[model samples]
Every structure is written in C-alpha cells, then in structure tokens.
Target: MSGRRTTHEDAHDPAPTWTPRLGDLAHDSSADRTGVVVEVPGDGVFSYHLRPERGGADPEWTAPADGSTLSPADD
Candidate 1:
C-alpha cells in the first residue's frame, strides 16, 4: 500500500479559490471608473490592469483591498 495516510482535516479542507480573468468587468469606486480586466499581475501588491470602459490610452493599475469598495461591474 502507499505510505500516505488520510486525516479528517485533509478531507475537510476547502478547495483553492479563483481570481478574475482577462475580459472580466470590474469597477473602481474611488476612481469612478468601470473597465474590463486587461491584466492581472503583482506589482509589490496584487493589482489589476483595467482598460477604461469609456475608452482610454492605457489601462490603469489599481490594488483594491479584500473588502474595499472595488466590485464587479454590471456590464
């Protein structure tokens, strides 16, 4: 038999969560801008690059706290 043994904790462990992907819509209340997720990368902190829904030159980078005002955009 294999050497590994199972435990109750292991069985009850939650699965890994997921993050947003490119093309997903998000909003920044502080900036009052709605945009699509252009890129997801770490720049010292976990941040998202967003392309403005109203059209812009370059995507803006923002690091929104876990329970902050940032939220999914309706469009």
Candidate 2:
C-alpha cells in the first residue's frame, strides 16, 4: 500500500478550524448544538456570542471565535 493517506482515511480526522463571523451560523461542537453568531467582541477568551437560530427564550451563549470549538453550521 502507498504511504500517503487518501480522502477516506482523512474522513475520521478532526474537523478543520473555522472562524465565525457576525450573523454567521455556527455549530458548537463541544455543546453539540447549532447557533447563530450574534456578536464578535474580538477580545477575551470567549469572543463570540451565539443565539439560537429558531428564536427561543434561551439566552445567548458565548464561545471562542478562534474556531477551535465552533464550525459553520451545515444547511
């Protein structure tokens, strides 16, 4: 077999880091939930605030804007 890895082999690899922008929909991998990007303070450890896209009474939550814990939500 070849030493190089194939796409299939990479499928199990960790997801690439994703940077979240304002008004962008992102998924919280750690929380296993989806939310909309509502704020980007650009400071502090948790620099992003995400609100539920469905418009719920649930309060907004904070996340890291560095994409280490967030990914673009799949449509």
Q: Which stretches of candidate 1 lie over 4 Å from their true place?
A: 1-18, 42-46, 56-61, 65-69
Error of 2 at 33 (Å): 1.3
Write model 2 residue lDDT over 1-75, tens digit each, in one string: 878666986878876666688899999888787899888865554578889989879777887656677888999
Estimated TM-score for each candidate: 0.50, 0.66
Give lDDT for model 1: 0.66
- The runs of at least 3 residues in candidate 2 whose Cα sits more than 4 Å from the true structure, single-residue gaps closed, are 1-17, 43-46
- What is the Cα-based lDDT of residue 28 in candidate 1? 68
TM-score winner: 2
Q: Rate the local accuracy (lDDT) of all candidates.
A: 0.66, 0.80
lDDT per residue for candidate 1 within 17-70, as digits (tens), equals 445567778776777877877766655646666787767685576745341545
